[model samples]
Target chain A: MSIERLFIANRGEIAVRIIRAAKELGITTIQAYSEGDADMLAVKLADESVCIGPAKATESYLNINGVVAAAIEKSADAVHPGYGFLSESPEFARAIEQAGIKFVGPSADTIERMGDKVAARQAAEAAGVPVVPGSKGRIESVDEAVEVAAKVGYPVMVKAAAGGGGKGIRIAENEDELRTLAPQAQQEAAAAFGDGGLYVERSVKSPRHIEVQIVGDGKKAVHFYERECSLQRRRQKVWEEAGADCLDDQTRENLCMAAVALAESVNYRGAGTLEYLYEESTNEFFFIEMNTRIQVEHPVTEMITGFDLVQEMIRVCGGESLSVSQDQVKKSGHAIEVRLNAEDPFMQFLPWPGKVERLKIPEGEGIRFDHFMYEGYQIPPFYDSLIGKLIVHGKDRTDAISKMATALESLEINGLKTTVPLHKALAKDPGVASGDFHTQWLEPWLEAGNLTPENT
Target chain B: MAQVLSPLPGTFYMKPSPEAALYKNPGDPVAVGDTIGLIEVMKTFIEVKAEFAGTFSAYLAVDGVPVTAGQALAELVV
Candidate 1:
């Protein structure tokens, strides 16, 4: 099971990170890119590269056959799908395995189970994990939704059962909003995930978003503590930090155990994040969902634990057992990560893609920048605007914030607007610094400043 | 500019499922709304229309091939 050549079915900083990790393990890396990304960092860093298709994500990144053909053409022994795109698709994983190439993630059945929100909920409930009160299956029409909402009580969260990135979720205050928003949510979910399944849950107000990172080998598993990702805009995480400050020791232990139990129940392998909504008042945390791939904020956990998660994932794919026991896991210091996007934060966060004429990255002891940019690199008009991530780790949250502030001040990229100003403002906010924030913290704060429209 | 248009993301069907005539062929003068090809995604069939008045140039992806989003199903000489 010694992998010699590996094909990366992704692009950007995470792809670059995976390439480096593969190179470290004496595995030749083949980087796959879309048309605009042919000259990107991952292409330059890998031992080989291939342009799968044009710049549009659906053709290049999400195309199952195209990615499989690239791996087969390169004669790669394994394929590592970094976060986003087809990372969590069970069909893609099955295709790679059918092509006689090892997929550097979990089993197809495991992915299939965890991918369906209802099935995953059943698994969680079966494992005795605390889950939010919600419907057990997809609601087809408005009547079913109303009936479920009535039983679940008022102020329920209507979610696209097959959705992610907060795209198709609606918070309904009454029966009318639920009925009105259901069709729109279904259409969006159909367009995005190709599934229009809907579900209901009692909306947990003012809960801090906490998730536990776990690495398993289909046999043994261990938890890597928790990350408090309450600082989010539009359900997309803007900032993340390791060792959630609000969690007491008992709560942290319980949360970690819940994550482990959930993983063990499904025999999940590689890196996955078990998300939960933690209510500080009751010290109760309920299982939300599990991301079946490497997370965007994985670097924060890696910073605290001193483990190369990408490399470990590769090793697990090659049939390696769990490298560390539960007792060996330790959370040290603090790390904060911000996604640097080529976006106009003032213009409702619209995509601002162009060329980077001048780029200056930060340099300091605790500042780490994961980016795919250089001077004169064209910020392509296609794909996600996340050009990089600025991750700063320190001995404490205050020190991490100060380092991130300094790093943001020093970092510069011209020829396109970015979310740098927004991150800078967030870092300086007292509420964010004190960790006295909830899931709905960012919108109201930004609206009060007139930074965005009220609905935004 | 000769705008080369193609099908959006969908499954490609060439010969109307072995019972009907082929949609179009090379050198066919197609109007804007002419049915040049059929693409399906998630069990829904959508006709690939020529965005502008053009002559169908070539078929880039073969019939029955699963075309992804932004894939070139056919080249159009506008």
Candidate 2:
């Protein structure tokens, strides 16, 4: 590998994750942290550490110039931006490349293209990937709306071109309903935003969040299969599983191939994910967007495929070709990952950051807890609440869920409130075990007081 | 004289938003349950409400500065 020295441009558990991967690759890891994160675990684990800026992320982790300068000053050969912060910033990638340091992800151009919604949708369509059936643009008349609706199928959602907060929106189950609702929506929109322009889209009912993980060497690409992240609250994934059990073998093959096709079409480099909204009833998947960097749920994919994604991405971005091919990438058992956040799950998921007074992690095969916490560590309240992620692998989905439940029972972090009880309740939920949940399931479940003390 | 303590550990904001005016200025009257400031913890903005009615004296903690739980945020003349 050409990357002899790696600078980690992120913090928290992902920072620790990158350091470990870089160390295993025989590379010196330089951790970049804020003033408040001087005592973070990643700093201690890295071969060297530097403070980029203050506690505020806007002036620190998200500061491209500061991060780039720190990396260059440290004589780093490459920079690895873990998930969040500047991970998907094209400017950051370009700055690193211009500074004669490799960025452990896609090219700046690729990041910019994939970051755009319209551009990415066009790319997906050009690559023969199915996108959510919708109007080409704003429909001027009810006739145009109906024409678009017939092709996209029913039920359809009529939305205002300039609308927010659920205003000027209506759902129609059939043509008759569309005929009635479209004009009403148009009038409402015109009255509200003074723009009667409307658009129609095939409303995906009870959609499940599925994404395929793909890696490329900017020449060829391959997929590591799919992950189901349907369990979400406030649109943030709470629990994720690899090799979505909801998909059949044929559907899984098609979904994975479609992702690889999209990745190859863009000449994508390093790790990327193609998020799709899948409808269970029709077994149809619609491409939504692409994440240009590694994700929080990446470890679940790693657990099932036994592929070190971080190391692989580093190798490829360091001017090396993909070390593994499509056929060589094989997935074994099912794996589930639950995010452990520093929040009081019972109290409206309020953020609770405090010193770690005691720590006890579950230990056994098929169990992995990726975290940056240690005894006496004080978790700073300046960043996101994600403290750790608990992952488990098993022979199948049921077995994985069982292992997760047992692991949650043994895992303990004292002197701080966390979402442990939330995961414990989910692990035992019959709806979760039967895979009968959707992307909108968790919030309503919480609203129904399902995460009570007795449930945990 | 009394002090209004922070209910949580985080960055304290005297205003609702960057462009907004201060919730209470020095010498402003403060009533029970009136919002005095906001404490942003882990990206969640929680309102810091006054528990004791008094005349607002001065802010003990600087705006947009980090503060620990029970830290005096503002002084009040009872």
Candidate 3:
């Protein structure tokens, strides 16, 4: 049941990435695009192309029916949803399954089960993965919240069960604080989402965003180690590194094994990541959630482990077994990846969708830039601002940082304002170089004017 | 007659949301700094404001259509 033709139902740099991987596996690539994306790089590189719908995403990329119809029309053997969009959509996967086309990901049932926060937490607990100690379910009154807070230990986070995007969240240092904040959070939640249910959980102080990359074949699963993505702004990761230096060997082993345990418990398929909140001081990590698809920072894991995750996922989803054993999946060196977005860093990171007049990419043994841009290519403004990702590998973390700094200097994309300057400043910053930061570190660093032109 | 040009190249929306009313209609009064429409660029919405007080004549660009930078979006009679 090997896939002979793979249809990519996404756009941007990831679309180009999938096409390259599919071609390397001797699979014919069919790229689906909207009217505005007809001139995109993936469309030009794929073996065949089809227009799904109009420029609007509702009628195009995000349109499940349109994407599935296009794949069926092209007679694609499998559909590769490159992260975001429909990558984690159970409905899309069901539709593709009903069409009798292979979906290069987990089954629809797995997606649905893991997509729910409460269900995912329960699964993690059943698999012996450590989750944040908290209330079992929604708490009704302030007295119940105080009882849960007493056991979980304060400073605990009082969160609205139905709220998202950091809304209706409050931190309470003690029972008194929880009593006062719980009622407000409940009221806000009821007003915003029509749900007053509350969930209380212990908050990890100065947490680092660490995640383990795992891939499975619906029977067995293995881990590819961990990645640290603590440097973020507005909840979006700006920089990422593989083989978190902050973790000791024993902790890293335990973390990776726990991720595999969960993956195998669900008979997970394709590439997935288990995100965790790692506290350096306590040397403890708690399972946050599992991303049901390949992630944006997957290249860093690939660089260190030397595994083409995309190709492996395609093969396994096509009915092949795990390619490598746990002992055989060895890691070497350190890798760093910085998101290169089409943004004006000096202008408060405003979106800049200018044409790429000229392009000069750094080329070396350890430097790689995954992008979908070319000279004279006008970046479409209707999508995300991520134009590319610059990845560099070296002997160790220090060496990787130095190589990244040099690569940032040589890389150029003319006629467009990018986040290059921001990365340049970060590469040389003392805090980043020492790897002494947390999830809440980047915003304050930016506020202190560390990214000024003169600083870089 | 003066033309209101789009500030960015992206989709143009006459209403804030699909179910919301239009921000401005033909023959409506427009004051300086009044929002006439919105231009969505790379998922970020930027308000297109009237630079001069005038009477709204007509929209030159269709709603929910792609527009280029500095393209005429609407007409205003000063």
Candidate 4:
């Protein structure tokens, strides 16, 4: 099947990234955007663009019917949802398929199966993959949740079974907290995911978040090693690195194989991530969840493996086989990515949307900035605060850290406050540099070391 | 004083109970914590309360219309 024109059903740097990849493949690109994003870099960079809907994301980006209409109107052969928004939405995937355009990710059924955390956990368990002890199914009542918690033991996590993003999740140390927190969590989950279904799981305190990147063509799968995304705040990832330095050979191989096994078990296609929680003391890893689309931190994997993952994804969608086998793929130097959001880390990380007054970017060997900012681009408040990602790759962790520090120094955006200073401090921290970090690393580092700019 | 506003984002409904009469109407007296309506977003219903004592003016958002963060739901005559 020839992909004449591809419609990107998302925005930001990811849209631009997909457009560039399509251009390289000699395919015409059609960019879709809401009202506020018409002049975005992706729209300007693509061959053509269409206003999908109003500035409100629900009426626009997440408007499944509108996106399908845009794809149909543009005569696009395939629609690429570049992470977030409707990237993992099975309904959107089905709508694209119904509109006679190929959805550039996993099959719709696979998305549905992997979307619910409970079903996904069951699938992993059935496949012989170790999953954290939790509720066997969705808990419909607070009483049910309490019962499940007692069975699972204390210090359990209450998660919105239908949603993610750290929302609707509460860790209760005892039944009293569980009883109060459970209803609140359920309400929040219902508000966030449109499904109030809750589930219980064993909480892995001080565990490192490691995930393996895998690609499949429906018949076979290959692993691209793993990424360490231990640095996070409020359950959102901030800093990510590829080829975690702390892993020994045995553990690394085990994690990689486990990821591949899980992918094969489900007949997963395209790009997917199998997240795991690694306990340093026991060296045990348990499957957490499977993200059916390309992740926000895909660049780290690309840098370490020298692979254009987006291009590979498009090819896979176009009915091509996996390009590189397990043996052929290589993990090179250390790579790190720090998200540059238009928010002040000190001021509770509130979104600061404004025009870029003076933009000075970091430039040097092994440093790449993936952003859509210019001298006068207005950062819209309607969407996520992530303006760009600053990625640096080097021969080792030390080199990568030093290079990232230099890059952060060279970076300047005068109009809006950013987390650049926060990243800079994190890069220079002894614990971070040595890779002795956990999922709780970033928040405490900011609090204890006074990395917030105001503290200075 | 002017009424503050609803704290959460959702679909605004004027009546508390579907079978009961509306809570407040134009020129009706309201105080802080008085239930103005119900806002349902993603199946979660949150009561929209009057932030201050005032006379009800008009509903800014239509019934069952989805609202977002900080979008006005109603107005009041201080």
| Cα displacement (Å) at residue B34, model 2 | 1.3
Which model, 1 or 3, shows the larger DockQ? Answer: 3
> Which ranges of candidate 1 are over 4 A from the true structure?
A134-201, A450-456, B1-78
CAPRI verdict (incorrect, acceptable, medium, high) for model 1: incorrect
User: What DockQ class does candidate 3 belong to?
Assistant: high
Model 3 C-alpha lDDT per residue in residues B1-78, reported as the tens digit of each score: 999999989999999999999999889999999999999998889999999899999989999999999999999999
TM-score, every prediction: 0.76, 0.99, 0.96, 0.79
lDDT for A142 in candidate 1 is 77
How far residue A143's Cα lies from its native spot in candidate 4, in Å, is: 19
- For model 4, residues A1-456, the per-residue Cα lDDT tens digits are 857799999999999899988999999999999986877899889999999997668899999999999899999999999999999999999988777788889899999998998789888888777888888879899999889888877888999989678999899999999999999999999999899999898777789999999998888889999999999998889999998887898999988988888788888888999999998876778898999999889999999999989988888888888888999889889999999988777766655666799999888888888988888987766677798999999998898988898899889998888888888778777888778889977777767756855432
Worst 10 residues of 2 chain A by lDDT: A159-168
Ranking by DockQ: 3, 2, 4, 1
By DockQ thresholds, what CAPRI class is model 4? incorrect
Among all windows of ten consecutive residues in candidate 3 chain A, which has the lowest summed lDDT? A447-456
Please write out the lDDT profile of model 3 over residues A1-456, one tens digit for every residue.
Answer: 799999999999999999999999999999999999999999999999999999888889999999999999999989999998899999999999999999999999999999998899999999999999999889899999998988988899989999797878999989888888999999998988899999999989999999999999999999999999999999999999998999999999999999999999999999999999998988989999999999999999999999999999999999999998899999999999999999899988888999999999999999999999999999999999999999999999999999999999999999999999999999999999999999999999999888898977
* Error at B54, model 2, angstroms: 1.8
Scored by lDDT, the top model is 3
Please write out the lDDT profile of model 1 over residues A1-456, one tens digit for every residue: 778999999988899899989999999999999875788988989999998997557788999999999899999999999998889999999999999999999998899999998799889988888888878778878789889999877688888988688978989889999989888888888898998899888887799999999999988889999999998887889999998989999889989998898899888889999999987776778898999899989999988888888898899888889888899988789999999887788877766666799988889787888888888887655566688899999999898898898899899899888888898888777888888998988889878883432222
Which runs in model 4 stand beyond 4 Å of their true positions? A134-203, A454-456, B1-78
Question: Which sections of candidate 2 miss by over 4 Å?
Answer: none
Q: Which residue pairs show collisions in model 1?
A: B11-B40
Per-residue lDDT of B1-78 in model 2, one digit per residue for the tens? 988899889899999999999999888999999999999999899999888999999988998888999999998999
